[model samples]
Target: MVQLWKLVLLCGLLAGTSASLLDIRGNDVLRRLISGLERGLDTFDSTIEIIFQNLKTELESRCSDEVVEQQETENFLEQLISRIFQVVSRLTGVRIRNVQVPDITFEATSENSANVSIPITADVTVSLPFLGEIVDLDLNVDLQTTVSIETDTDDPQVVVGECTNNPESISLTVLHSRFGLLNDVVDIGVNLARRVVSSVVEGELCPRFRELLESLDAECVEKLIGESQDTTQQEPEGRR
Candidate 1:
């Protein structure tokens, strides 16, 4: 009986030892798996942070580039206005005292996936000095022009003498009285307006003013003046 009891106790001890070993092995495996999962989570967090930083940098760069480009465009437009004034003055045979660009606006709208429409509004002022005994009269005119740019085409079409927004054109009329001659300055004012409009359309300065001059009715005025002068000269000569 004693031997049988001892044998049973030995068997029980062996079974307990095997169960404890299995428990220790299972705990070690669980700890290793938890550590590996933590490491994986940290790596994922680092990757996400890197991606976010890169995205932020890219956005900043794009925004900065846009700002610089806008400033450059504004400068170029100011220069263009100055050049236009130079051309108009030469064409009109007048000395432009100053050229001012009061306002410049650029608006862009997306029409579709492929096309965008950009409208530019420029408010310009041209000052012309008094010429040929025209005293106490300063010729300063304000012109508001709006130009459209179609992004789909390579060459943009410019329409002059027609305001896209307003049917009525902005114009200045001048009347001059000199030396009892009673000459009208209607053609001069019209010529100046036409010259400015043409400059805007051509987008550059041209040496000759023939295009704008030919469009005016200056020849009719000259013919009437010439006939009057000839009649006056003949009458005075016959009397003498």
Candidate 2:
């Protein structure tokens, strides 16, 4: 259950890595990075919905029990719900609608350091089941983070890496929902949310990003080798 919470938070904050910053030429790199982030978040939302349904079912079952027959079960359910609420309370939103990630700009600072900046806008609904109310919470957030890129010894052209985001310094703007403004209330848990998100980014997301970089690097190497072979094969024996 604790691990699940970490995953939930990771779905919110993202990560990555690379080599001495290569001059990023086209939108391809940014496109690929955002694609992974979007996919991770989409999966997160679906997984949460599934979990919510499962938990709701369990709660209903516990509540349906005969009072005297399952006193212990009732007690356990109460404690579980309380803990669950505490976890949910720290999140700013419960459901995400549209996510718009603007073009990302990346610059390599050194062989081991690279920085990326992007603006993300999203529409989300905040549901407080414990309070029996749901509210809209739109957001505009600025993301700035650094990644560590290491060159593979066997293949120096291939870079392996990981990223750590400065969540504590992330700029976030919460807009009023149609229902009302809840920033004051949500602000109370903003730091908590940031901390949880940071943990996931550093732990799970970073490793996954590293894997992605490695995979891309492998594909590039294969393509180059194939092209070289084709070029050699095309040469005439007379030239030799």
Candidate 3:
């Protein structure tokens, strides 16, 4: 009779242990982890704005008549950009200001991947060097980027799987303008250039985004994901 009681207690203990181990959902852990990561890299928009600021400065620099000679000729891309900046800057100075970041949200897309929505707004001022401040634009951009934990190698790290911008979500409203014709021209120019801009932003942002993730404590992410991994190991035992 004592042996029978002992068996009942053992089975109960085993069942309890299995429940405790399997109770944690991988998605739940991932959500919290991604939330933490988002907080850690809250300066994502600011970083993006900095890139644009650099672009503005570069444009202004290249716009000057006494052109700065190319220090690095290896990159043909830079040479092409310098020419574009010179023409645009000489015609009209583009100043980006009043930048704002949006509340980003995340959704678990896969075991180790998430989809994040980011919306940003900025004010763009276009000025003819001689005429001054010809047009002011309110720019709105909405984009989504896929972030994932890459663990194929020894060092598990966060990477940007993909970044996409909603074409319909991009708009440049002429808030105030001195020249209506120039404003229309600028609007058309922006519309035509939007895709190229998005492509450049995505290319520029991914590397910075990866760097932000790398800067954070990767071990914390590993621990959060590891807990789920450990819990899943109990499946065979539970079946028994």
Which has the higher TM-score value, candidate number 1 or candidate number 2?
2
Q: What Cα-based lDDT does every candidate model obtain?
A: 0.34, 0.40, 0.47
Q: lDDT at 56 for candidate 1?
A: 37
Winner by lDDT between candidate 3 and candidate 2: 3
**RMSD values, in order shown:** 40.2, 23.1, 28.2
Clashing pairs in 2: 18-149
Clashing pairs in 3: none
**TM-score, structure 2 vs. true:** 0.38
Predicted structure 3: lDDT:
0.47
Off by over 4 Å in 3: 1-92, 150-157, 165-169, 181-184, 188-203, 214-240
- Give per-model TM-scores: 0.30, 0.38, 0.44
Sort every candidate by lDDT, greatest first: 3, 2, 1
The runs of at least 3 residues in candidate 1 whose Cα sits more than 4 Å from the true structure, single-residue gaps closed, are: 1-74, 108-170, 173-183, 199-240
| Tens digits of per-residue lDDT for model 1, 177-199 | 23222122323333434444433
- On TM-score, the stronger of 2 and 3 is 3
Report the Cα lDDT for candidate 2: 0.40
